[model samples]
Target: MTQLADQRPIAAAQEAAVDPAVNSSSTTTSAAELEQLRRARPRGPHRRSPLAQVGVRLALALVAVVALAPVAFLVSLSVRSTDDVLTGSWLPGGFGELAWGNWSAAFRTIPLAHMLANSWLVALGSALVTAVVAVPGAYVTARAGKRGARLSAALLAGYCAPPVVAVLPLFFLLKEVGLTNSVVGLALVNGLANAPVAVWLLDSFVRRVPVELEEAAWLDGLSVAGGLRRIVLPLIAPGLVAALLVCTFLAYGEFLFAVSFAQTTASQPLTVGLSLFQGDRTVQFGQQAAAALVGVVPVYVLAVVAQRWLVGGLSQGALK
Candidate 1:
């Protein structure tokens, strides 16, 4: 009887080893392990309900429409007759009645092609100047620690001051240098004025470049300048391009200095040339709109071409 009792206990032990149900501890351990694995698994973005998705899409569409309303109006105005434009019609009268001659008239009234060339020259020069000044400034500032902060503050302080404050001084300076009433003069002024903004933008990008790369270059026998040229500059090209585009846009739309500096048609940009559409007694609204549309084309094309780089450059360091 004692031997039978001992055999019964041995059989129970064997059953517990073979069957998980017979061993609660083993079952509990497996469940705990599974729970831990479930906790460790990364979660995906929360799935929105169909209704929520529709609402979000609709909101985006609405914002797009609102933002594009002015552009749509401009397009309509470009095709409208002088009378229709004067009447302030929201839409053009009819497709058949669209004044296609306004485009030709605009080209004839102003030296549109020449003004466009001048604008391009000024804008490009301004961008070049901004890059030349800002790139180095940004680099120096990025690595300068507290001194950089002070320098950046001073630069931005200059930026914060109204453009009007410097207009007289700049004009006189340009006049003394014989740059007044010239595209080159205008470009130089715009470029200098935009340098602060470029510096601010480019500093972020320069900071994004890893210091280890520069150290590696140094170990490879490259100087600071050489490393900047071959290593840092290439990595920050997108930011440089973005800064150039921003400066170009700013210079292109600058009217106060363009009007103040460029007195003759030879030196005037598209911004100044647009005034030619207005007369003492009459305004060529359709023609002006047509010319404005022409001016918008280059800017639009640039924005589209550089949109990706611009966004990336601007968005860097935002998260950190």
Candidate 2:
């Protein structure tokens, strides 16, 4: 009986140890499952539902199609014959007969080379010259005393004055001196008309440059002009680009003044060249379309090139 009792305790101890391992294993498995559940739970922000995702994708596709439609039309129209256009056909009846001769018709009708050259001279001259005069004027306006504010306000008021109202006086003034038909005279008018706009834009831009920067340059033995040339010029480049683009585009697209002033095809800008096709006999739609396109291409190219500078120039002045 003593031996059996001793054996019973030993057996009990062994069983207790085995039972603990089983219980611990079960607990550990449960804990692991709980941890996985916590990890798999959704985070704080709302989830993108399936419906919302599908709707977003559909909206993007629709917008893309809409945007691409015009480009598709232009490309198609440029190649199509008059019959294809008149019939409202989507594609030319024949695919291989795409006529590129319309572009030649456009060139011949509009005096494209002469207009292009004139437009380039006027646009480039106005932009570069405007930048030269406007930058200094803007710097002065920004740095001027309280008296300068009154002057600037007056100038801004004049800028808002109607160009139509000023045109009569301008026409007479140029006509009086026999400058009405002159390229230099036209450039002067363009520059003057555009200067006020440049002044306002550059004034705002100049105000944003930190005063401390100039002072540091001054302390380093640089003159005011030197400091401005080195520091201010580089920083204000975007504004200059933006301002130049605006001036050039306005000058290039100017029809009223060019119509009134330019008598000879030699002096006429691109804007007026397109109108010469309207003879009493007939209207050349193909030529008209071509000329319209030629006039637009240069302006489009100008805007595209200056787009980055324009964004920067417009924004920088606003914040400061």
Candidate 3:
């Protein structure tokens, strides 16, 4: 009986150990099954109903139509005759009725070629100047720590001040320097005006460059300028392109300064020259539209070409 009792206890212990191992095995299997089921479950896209997908697509289509409507109208109006435009037709007339002569007439009526050349010079020059000034300023400010922050803040303050407030002062200064009514003068003014914005934009891009790369260059005996040229410029090429395009667009579309400063046809840009289509009695709507279209083409082309870089640069800066 004693031997039997000992044997019973031994059996009980073995069963206990076996029960735990079995339980553990079952639990692990259950956990793995649960994980598998989770992975197999339908995701977000699969959960969306056909109706919901249709609704989303329809909403996007509607938004696109609404946004493009004005542009379509402007293009249609540009190709129409004055009579057709005056008749308030929303849709353009027949192909035969299209006033192709309006384009020729628009250029002939004003010094369109000269104005275009002047605008290009001012826009490109301002963009170049802004890039030259802003890149150095941004690099210096970004590397200067707290001093850089203070300097950047000061620039922002200057930029925040209304341009109109300083227009008269700037005009007088340009007049004194014999730069008034000249494309070069307008470019310089535009460049100065946009310098702060360029700095703000480039500051973000400059700071994004890895300090390790610059430090490596320094260790190799590269000067700051050399480091920037070798390491920084290539990295920030997109940001530079974005900034240049923005500066060009701003200078190209600038009407207030062009009108205020450039009085003569010889120096007038397209923005000011477009106003020549306006008569004291009645506006030549078709011809004005044609001129406006001509002026907008270059900007539109630039926007399309640099759109990816522009969006990426702006978003990257904003995120930083």
Candidate 4:
């Protein structure tokens, strides 16, 4: 009896030692499995690297720096004195040395008021004239293709024509007609030069207008011209504004032939007035930059105003 009881206790102990859970706790995995588990365990959070992220951010910073450089230089030059501008580098170590006399004398050297009026007259006049001529031409061309479209395209070509090509002939023609160098003469020239583009713009726009509106108007005994003036013109006023803005900007910045056509400050535009600052020896970069910035204001204003029309006009043509 004593021997049997001791044997039973030993057998129970051996069975507990051979259990799967006890074996797994100490060393379940084989040598190869243990090696793989040790290798697979992550050493750190940076499994790869953030180099690509750093590179993208760096590239964006470079672009921003490049873009801001010119604008910053321009502003800096504008505020600095002429001596600082001429003697000092493009960058000034100090801000106090800037010469502000150019801005102060800008009005005196030229009849700035008169020049502004001339610029407005040329730009606004050309834009208005272009809208008038182009709108009808574009409408007809877009509504009636092939023949009318060709005619419209031919006119658009004139806008693309070199100013030099037109300048001599236009001058001679105007002189022969006794209209040379006059405000009226310049206005007419600007108007004629910009009209073709207007026609082309209006042509495509008119096609987007629903035919039902025109048919109803025609049934009411309104002639095509009358309908265009009343219904079509009103509907496309946004596009007209956009066209006016584009032509005005072109006319305002025009250089090549405007200089040739204009003679004195009495009739000369701002563009010409600004050019007088570039002396034979010293170019007043500060004053030039300031003046250029001043000119840019009107363009910015016109662009903002015109953009309001663009969205609605585009939506009407596209979404509808």
List the candidates' TM-scores in order: 0.84, 0.68, 0.79, 0.71
**CA lDDT of 267 in candidate 4?**
66
* Residue ranges of candidate 3 with Cα displaced over 4 Å: 1-56, 81-89, 92-100
Cα lDDT tens digits, model 1, 1-320, are: 99999899899889998887769887899999999999887765466668878998999999989967766777787778888887866888788989889989999999999999999999999988888889889999888977996898799898998888888888899989999899999989999899999998888778888899999999999999998889989988878887888889999999989998899899999999898888999888888888888888878888888889788767763533
Q: Which ten residues in a row have the lowest lDDT in candidate 1?
A: 311-320
Which one wins by TM-score: 1 or 4? 1
Strongest candidate by lDDT: 1
Q: Roughly what TM-score does model 3 have, to 2 decimal places? A: 0.79
Q: lDDT by residue for model 2 over 1-320, one digit each (tens)?
A: 99999899889778867799876877899999999999899865356678877888999999979966755665566666666677767776676777677778778776888787887777777776777778887888888856655666777789777777777888899898887776766777787778877887777778778879999989999999887789888888787777777788888887777777778888888778877766787545445556666666656675677778887777876776
Candidate 1 backbone overlaps, count: 0
Which candidate number has the best TM-score?
1
Angstrom error of the Cα, residue 142, model 4: value is 1.9
| Candidate ranking (TM-score, best to worst) | 1, 3, 4, 2
The alpha-carbon deviation from the true structure for residue 294 of candidate 2, after best TM-score superposition, in angstroms, is 2.1
How do the residues 82-129 of candidate 3 rate in per-residue lDDT, one tens digit apiece? 788889878677999988888888888998889988999999999988
Better of 3 and 4 by TM-score: 3
